[model samples]
Target: MSAGVELDHVTVRFGEFTAVDNATLDIKGGEFFSFLGPSGCGKTTILRTVSGFLDPSEGMVKIGGQNMTGIGPNKRPTALIFQNLALFPLMTVAENITYGLRVRGVDKTARTKKANELLDLIALPGQGDKLMSELSGGQKQRVAIARALAVQPKVLLLDEPLSALDLKLRQHMRSELRSIQRMVGITFIYITHDQGEALTMSDRIAVMSDGVIQQVADGKAVYDDPATSFVASFVGENNPFVGIITRADSSYAVVDTLFGTLRGRNPKGLKVGDKAILFVRPESAKLGTGAADTTFSSKVKSVAFEGNMTHVFLEGVGKKDVTITVGRHSSADIPAQDEIASVTYDVDLGLVLPEGKMARE
Candidate 1:
């Protein structure tokens, strides 16, 4: 049966360096949860703690409401699919999938039967007799997942298992993974730095930075309503206008920036004179719209056509370049380089945030 996982004020230390710092959260049973962050930001540390490979220096780890403080990974009702996969090259696909059952001394006939069932479960039916060397990268990934599932783990922990596949295959495997998780009806704890992977697969995401979780929410919430400047800039492409708040009310904040006054939603409740940044997504800015909530002029520096849309980079009222995305189907006029253009956007789509640490690319 599937089980919920929880971390209560978890902290992990390596010598004097704190890897994970007081992280507290819950992963619902049968839910797909992801921990997303840049490298060295302690995302993997939490996964390790939950997997029982490492114990937290402080606090508790629980699965199915049972404390996991003294448990070893082998004894826990969980399976970890490592980034390297760790499949035996000499073993056939079925042999690899049944390796765990073999280690537990399950009969060969039973192991083989279970392996065949898993082969069908992973959409690799009739390919179990093939050697590991004969499988493609994506095939190997599925085999690894099948092996993990062979144990019928209550919680499955994956650490960037898709990192080795090409772009198209990785995208395909994301769907496959999600489908497999649903079929098994188990809690999935995925660790990844790839935003696309997390956003596409997770029921909820925990965005982390510098050993701290910046925000935890559904993908749309994290993207459309970021709780921090770091989240706003990191989740997607954004044009930032750094300035001091000129006026603020319960619903809106107006900032006096190099590009003149700009108003946006005031979810952060910034006061006048407070340093803030207004983050407007490229698609949020429209070309030559007089009916918009805010209007600004920019000198077009470059244009890159991307089939469905064109990205226009401009030199506006600041040192940094501003980018606006124009959909091909829109009635807005596309401009040539060196031409002046007016851009406008609604205030509600713009996100104003108090200046804080942003993610480094």
Candidate 2:
């Protein structure tokens, strides 16, 4: 059983420094929500605030409609699984799993029974008596999860628990974590700097930078369409073309880049003279279409092939350095070049953003 969480205007301050600046979000019951950002972006600070290990400088942390203010981590209906996990190495897996129950005065038999049931749930049914040191890394991760679940917490907090694993194992663990969340039906709030982990495991992701959330949306939306220049550049690969808004309409704008006038989605409420940026993902850039809205030429600066895909870097056409990603099947076997070549995209494929709108992460 897991509980939903709500952070209303939650702000964390360490003396004069604000770690989390008025962050607000509602995480529904049984949903897997992720806080994703680079280090020192206040993601961990917010997670600590939610677990009651640290109180907010101001604002409220609510679980299941109950205020969590002044509540210690031990007293809250939430269980936090730190990156280290802190499993007792001297104890058997069963003993480690049931340590929380035993400390809470659960009878030995009952604790053992609960431990076995969780081991089974975690797919280690018959390994209860094995020492904690005997399990593999992934298995140890499962045991840690089982231990957290033993308390039947309404909310489970994980602080980058998958960071220590290798790439393949990390990918495997993302699926494991999501499946476990579904089985327990508890709200899971995960903190991670790895975009792949967050994108793979989360129901919704909050993109944070500079102690503020830039966008909170479903994974595809956050990747396919970003709300800000920061999100466009950070969430995934994008070619940011800086320019001034010259011609503006309700649906698109003509940006005056060094390469000349380029039409992009009209950002309404933007004045014609205001400086703005245009974002075009690599996938959106393609071979010339010979049409008015589908042409932009660039001097092919460089190209690199990584077997599955090709990276094309462009420059010299008055436009700044822009990269184009082409899949192996779709990419032509063109040699790397310093010569000029035209690249194109439909006008609708690019997004116009206000200049200097994103604070650094």
- Local distance difference test values of all predictions, in order: 0.91, 0.85
Candidate 1 clashing pairs, residues 3+ apart or interchain: none
TM-score to true structure, per model: 0.96, 0.93
Best by TM-score: 1
Q: Write the per-residue lDDT of candidate 1 for residues 258-354, one digit (tens) a residue.
A: 7778889999888999999999999999988554347777789999999999999999554568999999898988999999998899889988999
Model 2 clash pairs?
2-154, 3-154, 251-266, 252-265, 252-266, 259-318
* Model 1, C-alpha of 352: deviation from truth (Å): 1.0
RMSD of 1: 1.6
